[model samples]
Target: MNTLPIRPEIPWLAPLAGYSDLPFRMLCRAHGAGVTNTEMVSAKGLCYFNRGTSSLLNTHPEDAPLVVQLFGADPDSYHQAMDKTLEMGFRFFDLNAGCPVRKVTKSGSGSRLLENPDRLYAIAEIMVNKAGPGAVGVKTRLGWEKGVDTFLDVAKRLEDIGVAWLTLHPRYGKQLFSGQADWSRLAEVKQAVSIPIVGSGDLYTAEAGVRCLRETGIDAVMFARGAMFDPAIFERFHALMRGEESPPRDGEHLARIVRMHIQYTREFDGSDRSFRKLRSFIPRYAKGLRDIRSLRNELISCETWEALESAASRIREMQPADPLGFDPADVIPD
Candidate 1:
């Protein structure tokens, strides 16, 4: 068995629902993202053979080392999902135990799973045993509530169960993307676990990714909202690591990525759902571009690709409304 950590040669693209589809994944990869995860698929959905869930697992020959993240509270469902994934030729899988949405937590899944250490261990053990050799991993937060410290125990348990890697989103579940992520806690978990720790949360810039790696001493940093705000973050980070200044933010470059994203969305999903999902990304990508807020509103009101294209053209032509006055990095959540 090879023992090297699964560190991507470049930064990773964190999974985001309605955003990390194949088009976006390809865009990030082209922009220098090393590893990318599929949007979270429900284990229960996979067990029941949901078509959308199955679509979420779609990958091309080039989308290698891709990890598909599954969420559910049932061990049986997890087993079934892994079996299905293995049959489909997927070698990398991650259990999602960090989502804190009411729907997920109310079902005793996601972040709620961390409240019980034994259950978390059992889940990881089952996946590792069933999936075999370097096949399974876990993504989790510190704990479900504030003032609680369960990450170390959870990380150790996952490591003991033979998890290939673990991604820690350093905020307590209850915090729910508010407040600063506890990077110190991530460092503590890094010290406790023998497995590679992928630090997540609040990594919004190339500088932030570097700082997180240096401070936490982890294997890699995962970008969530950062990738949404700036798909070129990975490319820029790579340049910075090579001692280059930041790349210029070009509206045309942003427009081209957005167009590719829209095309991929249409191909992966049908027109309606693709348009809806693609709309959410426009505002973020257009952050520093001039007149984008108005253009975004027009784009959102669009129903067809032609309408979206017209709006996109207008956006591409407009120079950033505030040159030297705004930062694209600031648009991402902190």
Candidate 2:
């Protein structure tokens, strides 16, 4: 029998609202992302048939093995929305129990669910039943507040309730993005659960990706802001895993991805909104490029695709200041 590779099993692209749109997803896939997730959508919004929510669920032929993430406090609405998701041909569904935004938690969603494991189990059970076997999963943080650890119990419950997988960010809600992620805790959860455990947070480099997988013994790894800064990270990590030297970052290729992303966003969500969304990724794409601050400022101010394309072309002409150490400062916190 041929044994499959276990460590660094899958290169995952995490869902960032407005950032992980189809264009960026396709770019990541082209480069080497193994699995990609959609941005978190409101279960209530989907149940209510909101146009914006519906558009977020849209996927192209190339966007296969996609996971659609849903956020809501009510189990009934979650069930209804997941039913609709399945009707729309999505096989994988993830429940968002980890978002720490004030607006989300205030509504009893996101990280707030960690406060009540029973409720979390109830919701996961309903989604699992609705999604049938091997269709449901959960993504969550370590706990709700500082110094509180609930991931071990949460992971076990999710496994017992038939969750196919679990993605742990390994940070408490109170910590937000500050401080380092507790990788040891992730290791603990990995040992506690039978389901596939995906360890997330602070995996910004290929070295860190390898370190996290080796240290935590996770089934796979998930990339959020790190992927935004370097879309080639997955490919680079894959090369490193195979005992090959990491490839050099190509500024021209990065610029081309930016252009393609802008076009795809425009095609997917017409009007200036798509352009506006594309602006969020500029800082990442332009990281380490000379005078990118000025270039990004100019690009963000452009109101049309033509203008955006012009600015991008100008950015492409300039060489990156530091080829290897250019980390984008505008990473979205998990």
TM-score leader: 2
What are the per-residue Cα lDDT tens digits for candidate 1 across 5-82?
356336888877767878788878888888889998998898888778887877777776688888888888888888
Off by over 4 Å in 1: 1-5, 321-334
Error of 1 at 147 (Å): 2.2
Pairs with backbone N, CA or C atoms under 3 Å apart (clashes), candidate 1: 290-320, 290-321
Assess the local accuracy of residue 47 in candidate 1 as a C-alpha lDDT between 0 and 100. 85
lDDT of 2 at 268: 65
How would you encode candidate 2's per-residue C-alpha lDDT over 186-229 as one tens digit per residue? 88988887878787889887778878988988888888877888
Question: Could you estimate the TM-score for every candidate?
Answer: 0.92, 0.92
Off by over 4 Å in 2: 1-7, 323-329
RMSD of each: 2.6, 2.8
Worst 10 residues of 1 by lDDT: 325-334
